[model samples]
Target chain A: MTGSPRPARLMDGTALARRLTDETTAAATALHRRTGTTPCLATVLVGEDPASVTYVRMKRNRCAQAGIRSRHLALPAATSTARLVDAIGELSADPDVHGILLQHPVGPHLDERAAFEAIAPAKDVDGVTTHSFAAMGFGLPGFVSCTPGGIMRLLDEYRVELSGKHAVVVGRSAILGKPAGLLLLGRDATVTYCHSRTRDLPSLLREADVLVAAVGKPDFIRGEHLKPGAVVIDAGYNPGNTGDVHFASARERAGLITPVPGGVGPMTIAVLLAQTVRAATRQLGLD
Target chain B: MTGSPRPARLMDGTALARRLTDETTAAATALHRRTGTTPCLATVLVGEDPASVTYVRMKRNRCAQAGIRSRHLALPAATSTARLVDAIGELSADPDVHGILLQHPVGPHLDERAAFEAIAPAKDVDGVTTHSFAAMGFGLPGFVSCTPGGIMRLLDEYRVELSGKHAVVVGRSAILGKPAGLLLLGRDATVTYCHSRTRDLPSLLREADVLVAAVGKPDFIRGEHLKPGAVVIDAGYNPGNTGDVHFASARERAGLITPVPGGVGPMTIAVLLAQTVRAATRQLGLD
Candidate 1:
């Protein structure tokens, strides 16, 4: 029989997210009690895409459970970029809406960056704007892009030593990969930003002490490409609940790994709700 | 001489900057003729730091030679953040000022970021603002920090292949290293950001196809740590007219290298002057 390697330690993002949400709930209650104003998260969905609809509804339900008010606007798929921007702008201008979440992939035709920019920086709970990006890049105090922000929380919860470690980010998407790399770099990790244009993926992957699998292709990275004992954070969630990393193989090679369904998904919601409360606290001058 | 290594091909930033300035001169002249408006650069210096004074004077002289107007504002060393911000804001609002340049290291007492943020995005020729950094990170249209912008031009002039190349940026200063890395990433180069906390410097150095030395330490990176035939662009300008790269040793190992005095320094001023013309063109509706 071949020698068996120790199975990777699983990062329990679900448990951490639940604890985080509980803390957020307490904060939300205290905030409401002090101001007598509910922290409202207004989610704007530009299209009727089934996936986006489910995501928005799930977030709204989570918000309700956390004592935060939820407001939903579902627009038709054919909504113009200008109209979508206008709708988000209106929500941004509304004093009652403490935070705004615009479901991404608004449509292929829509200029998503332009629409995201329309969300006021103060109300950008999802943290998808250039302002937030700038804040993350500058290492300044401001909102972070939600998915990556959750990734950081998971890393912290797991006690992964980031400083002086080599973190290879395997995507450069605006909301996820880019911000994740910046946040990691800000924490003093030597960060390599690899994307579709990167040459020799295996070479970089093999050297990554912490590999952020965020390319969005299901099971794109295999164990063969990974360094043994690498901390693997898979940010991919597909229709079948699969991840960007080959989970079974990755578990064999990685020292730590995050499961697809239970890992990053819940953390995203937790960070969003937390940021909403923080935004409310700031906007209401209760900070 | 049997084992003599081939000397590196020098990257002549001086010639490139001169050629760029000539082009800028023509554009500035054309703009003045068409709109009867001279491209004006307002140089705001807080405290008479000697090096800053010399740098500002050099820029003002370049503006004069290139047919662009320059306005100098010298604030006292005791200037508060609010006063400095207000002064920059006034120049930003002034239609006569086509661009604004805030001489950096205003003093130890000031918040440089807050002061840099005061420069309006439209007239930010120096590109030290968060807006410019975001633009670079997003690959969006906006001016870049002068030194990094110059670095790109030199890279382009030398026809260095950025796509898929591994670029190692050896600093993370807000104005220089961070923007430089972002620009390199936007060009499709796999970028690794190494800072003071980076461990095993030689390992990362050996993999760098293009090395950007911007750590502001004289001879911080040496030849022995370098990959043979790497293109080295040193951005450090020390008091003795030296650079971050140990030149003699770097030339022995590098395929191409920038000479200290002529390398990144002149290119920076050239980019600044060129951006001044652009800001003028856009503001005057000559674009």
Candidate 2:
């Protein structure tokens, strides 16, 4: 049996991210010239999660390409919470480190929130700090979570009007789902957050003008769940690089759909690099 | 023509808040006996906004009744942001000031976020600071905004089951609306936030097992907006002492409804006093 054709125009993160990185490189170079120090991002990885390792490496590589410095701290899988906190504390106090990124799923035993809180809000360039999240939610001036920031940038790029739209964000994770809903709310889109426990997810989906899938479940949201011509952002990256939404079916009904592998993933690193430069400039008073 | 008979069950805040205050008073007395210094809250108000003045007075009076100490700071209406920041910074740095409450709507010209950020997270017992907001959103240990905190307490008092329910919050303001939504989300509720710009808000409201009205509009949510057997919390207090939800109509539709003046307002002061004592105990190392 032949499958249905793709109906939505794909929101390409690769091209947009490349453009952003180019701009970030120029900013980084300018800051370095003025402050005599390159913008630096310290990445902390606690355990040996292969996926996390790949993500960190990708971030560092992107940093290098953007003329920013990268510092890696790899702790053992059995690292104690105190030791991890101490290491993060040191980075927080270090003036040389402009930004800090701690890859998630640190370890089964570690106090992840404590470690994240240890990072100074100013150096929380990855926007993982609680202060940043609150700031985003309150519509205050602060850094944003990378994926959510990327999603906002994409919306701006597409000129999708958010002011009066009904945005339904699937998932409520701190880094992705919760922050996404808050950001949309800040932009004047009335937002609804659906998670694993939500009843009748399909019914909620049908009422959304913009639907953001960040639940990490492959092909979880189907075509029948979507409202016609709704803007779809599939931020889920599962095994084999599939998205949370059934792309083929959702695309048929969506006005815009972002692909799994090349959509939100690329923009994460791009935002990190951009934020690192911003941090450096702010700290060095170069702006 | 006779008006429709009152159909809502009034969720009396005045009576519930009095009980809560009594409990807080007992807790405060116990703490005071254990520790010499009484639980103290520093109330900072910039300019004399009548509403803010009334609220501050109410908070202080409640503190006195609860055996909590109150320190008042009344700044001029034309206070500069930097000066205001310095004043807050001092309060935050003071060990004796266990909690700080900076009343909002501090003159239109002054930057409220900057001033709010000056309060140390440890002393931000009112949960207006960015740090507190993030902690609340992340489900971390932190004090919550008084009104939202009170709402949660009321729910617990009434034994409302929150897990796996759909909660629709009508408003997105910084302190009340947004924080209320986050608190519900943390409790495993699928939460949706509807505001003035929201399209088909009635549809969203009908899906809610729990409805929170905080839009500061009188009777914005009517009986038609409620789902049968829904738990309704009206946080709005307009000039005529009207709540956001039309309590009369809502009572017939909702399983529960908070009254206009007597419902959520009293709890706000109750939580503030409770948090002040808790903060004092923590600061005194007597907990």
Question: Once superposed on the true structure, which residue ranges of model 2 sit more than 4 Å away at CA?
Answer: A1-6, B1-6
- True contacts preserved, each candidate? 0.88, 0.88
Off by over 4 Å in 1: A1-5, B1-5
Residue A175 of candidate 1: its Cα lDDT? 93
Weakest 10 consecutive residues of candidate 1 chain A by summed lDDT: A1-10
Screening candidate 2 with a backbone cut-off below 3 angstroms (N, C-alpha, C), the clashing residue pairs are B7-B252, B8-B251, B13-B263
Tens-digit lDDT string for candidate 2 (B1-287): 12224455667788888987898899889887877688889999999889999989988988999999999999999999999999999999998889999999889989999999898887888888887888889888878998999999998888889988999999887888899999999998989898988887888898888999989888889887778778999999898888888877787778878887789988898888888888888888876
Clashes of each: 0, 3
Q: What is the lDDT of residue B46 in candidate 1?
A: 91
- Worst lDDT run of 10 residues, candidate 1 chain B, spans B1-10
TM-score of each: 0.98, 0.95
lDDT of 2 at B102: 94
